[model samples]
Target: MQLTNHDAANPSYWQARWREGRTGWDLGGVHPLFSELMQEAHAAGLKPNARVIEPGCGRAHTGAALAKMNYIVTAFDVSKEAVDAAKVLYANETKLELVVADLFALPSNWSNSFDAVYDRAVLCALPQASRPSYVHACAKILKTGGLFLSIPFTKLHISASEGPPFAVDEANLESLFEADFEKVCHIEKQHSVKDSKIACEMLIVWRKK
Candidate 1:
């Protein structure tokens, strides 16, 4: 599979998927790994009211969960349809701010604005070449010494010709974050996904330096 900007693996392609309700990637709700990570963060002394942002926050389940826990949660997605769905899903929660905005083109008013950023199915969703800019944007929006928690899909079967859920090995993941973050904890774990076990989901928690 040739990984290229012209491939069906770009952001516009994902936007179209959401428009057509073809988002197999939409898990309908929060992933269990996220819940476990939040539990760990709480145990590690993160306060309830921390400012949190979720980029590419499709359906914003993580935002909803954080809001319920009293965090000031903000979430954004480039696809307006996805944002609309998230709003409907999280309507009763006043603690979260859901906006339709491109991750790379975030509003100028938001620099250094968040205490922590949580991402799942966001970074790895992008085409491989676009990841560096995505990482840079995440770093820019995060406050100095803030936290970044990511659950990225790794070791997925994909040819260069196919993907929206792109694969990331340990080396690729490290190359994406090591320059911008102070690595804190990295875990490679198996996750139960419906009828099968996904053996290569990696969880990374980083403290912005």
Candidate 2:
């Protein structure tokens, strides 16, 4: 996926975007791939009782969707405005909690406590240096044998420096999750980048093993 808005490493940049209504990642509705996977996860017995976290949830559409489907969800974003919007959208959903906090600084009680971690754009959105922390955090928040659903943008033609949605590939994922998680499967689709270039889009699932 191409990131139209690339924010700085600082949180204030994103806060400004949210405050100014510059979010391009909020798809307004749940992404079809994520919606299908949520249903598939329910069929796999992770249903009304399962706990999930959506890190860096932009407008929290996916988390809200999951809450509607009976999954307990905690969606966090550094942007207070984003969280405020989400709260307004999900006022009646008791199954979801929206938090305004940095993903790296989540409370200790949350560690290793979730049945699943839904990493939408958070992984690739981070600067390269933060990826290890991100992977560790994802693994930490998920219980053993839990699942991690990652949808990261793969850099095919774009330079690594030209991104908030940084270029990533299987090697990046393996280097991050290989020790504590196993790649169960992955699907890649070519995405159109700027000026007719192509990017490798990946939907990967990892099971903590």
lDDT of 2 by residue, 1-209 (tens): 22244445667777877777877766687764775556545554465768999988877988988888778999999998989898988878899999988877888999889988888777877877878888888888889988888667775465666556676777878888899898766778666233232366777778887
lDDT of each: 0.79, 0.77
lDDT of 2 at 93: 85
Residue pairs in clash, model 2: 112-140
Clash totals in order: 3, 1
Q: Worst lDDT window (10 residues) for model 2?
A: 189-198
For every candidate in turn, the CA RMSD to the true structure comes to 2.9, 4.0
Which 10-residue window of candidate 1 scores lowest in summed lDDT?
A: 1-10
98, model 2: CA deviation in Å? 0.8
TM-score of each: 0.90, 0.86
**Backbone clash total, candidate 1:** 3
Q: List model 1 lDDT by residue over 111-199, tens digit each.
A: 89888898887777777888889889989998887788887777765554466567677888788888988877778877545513234
lDDT of 2 at 14: 77
